[model samples]
Target: MRLNNKVIIVTGSCTGIGKAIALRCVAEGASVVVHGLEQDLGEAVINEIEKDKGVLQIEEITNEGAPERLVELAVKTFGKLDAVVNNAAMILSSNMETTDLAFLRKVLDVNTVAPFALIKAAFPYLAKEGGCVLNIGSVNAWSGEPNLFAYSVSKGALMTMTRNLGDTLFRESGVRVNQINPGWVLTETEIQRKRSQGLKDDWYKDISSVYAPAGRILWPSEIAAAAIYWLANESGPISGQVVDLEQYPLIGRNPPKN
Candidate 1:
């Protein structure tokens, strides 16, 4: 009941964290625009939610006019837009030597530029309702792993944009902007991602304690629970904030040797 009668757009929500957030929003009495690259997955997500509580859109976030279409879906189906969860992103690995101009631009297009476009499109509706924007960022925004050069840079830019818009937009339009930097979430995509890296199927079952101090990575539902706070009116007048949801210290921590 926290988000009663609200309408939200959740990008890349066919699976993983975005999917979890979309479902949770519906459970809290909000209608959602479920979007992703996969049509089948998007339809499945819409089917799982209440019949009147969800709609589906299948498209690449970086496609021309895609952001406008997503905003239109929310307004047309649910009557208005109250929030946007910018969850779509391309997670690619690359080192300095391997990263090229095209590779970095592609990453930025999805992770950084696309999210900003969506926010711009949703701005008018959000301002009308005093709505919010919750950007799903990563702990990697701050000095990421060596292999995640392009990805880290993209997230870093997103974090900065969140802060800047959080301040200006809140002041100018009454639309709050905030970010959550999740660490090591055990999402469906992550499971497949690790497996593709040549790790065993059950690699997550035995993570190093240094990485997962709680003995397991965070779950999508956990992240969704936190997201509700920002999307709901309970987070009044609090903008320009970046929260890190991780098991261990993201900074200044010296892990014990294995």
Candidate 2:
């Protein structure tokens, strides 16, 4: 119970990595506020949390000032906030040549701006509790891919925000901020979508072998484990770091397996 009695707000918890992180937090004894745009999936996540006897709240965070509302709800319902996970993100594939300005704005709004606003809104509460912020960045932030221009740019900004916030909080507020970059996580929906695209079992096998470099694709829960470690109070000194949970060598050189 590393997070015993803590209150954590996870954005985009209706599905994918966010949902997994919310579930893990509740399992670790934290009261979780699940925020998403989808009411049905959001309520489903909250129900699952409640079934485990964990305190859970749900909020829709698509509107302007929604992040502030989410932080307020966490405090009013749980009495305090210990951690915030900026896990909500939207992925769009369009090269610079074909990308529209409106689509870029939408991507940036949801992926970058929303997280920035959430951090600002959650900062006061987290600072009061000496809590942590975990921003869900992407591996593309470091390496660029052609079609994922906007997503890559948004994640790049997110990483910068993590560093700036960490420094600011350290000097002024005592709150820790870090980032987690997940790679090729195969959630249920993603798997199903791949199947619908006529991808066979062998296609997935080839994908795991050729693309992920770990000989397998990651599960959402695996990424959640990294977040859990960062959010737990024991990791107080490990701030301002961008942790890559992609199982790839940081220096681009694969190390010998022990």
Top model by lDDT, which number? 1
Clashing pairs in 1: none
What TM-score does each of the candidates earn? 0.99, 0.89
**Which parts of model 1 are misplaced by more than 4 Å?**
none
Error of 1 at 154 (Å): 0.4
- Let me know the TM-score candidate 1 reaches against the reference structure: 0.99
TM-score of 2: 0.89
Q: Give the per-residue lDDT of model 2 (tens digit) for 3-90.
A: 8989998988889999999999989989988877677887778788856333344554557778888888888888999889998887
What lDDT does candidate 2 reach at residue 98?
74
**lDDT for position 49 in model 2:** 80
- Lowest lDDT sum, 10 consecutive residues, model 1, at 249-258
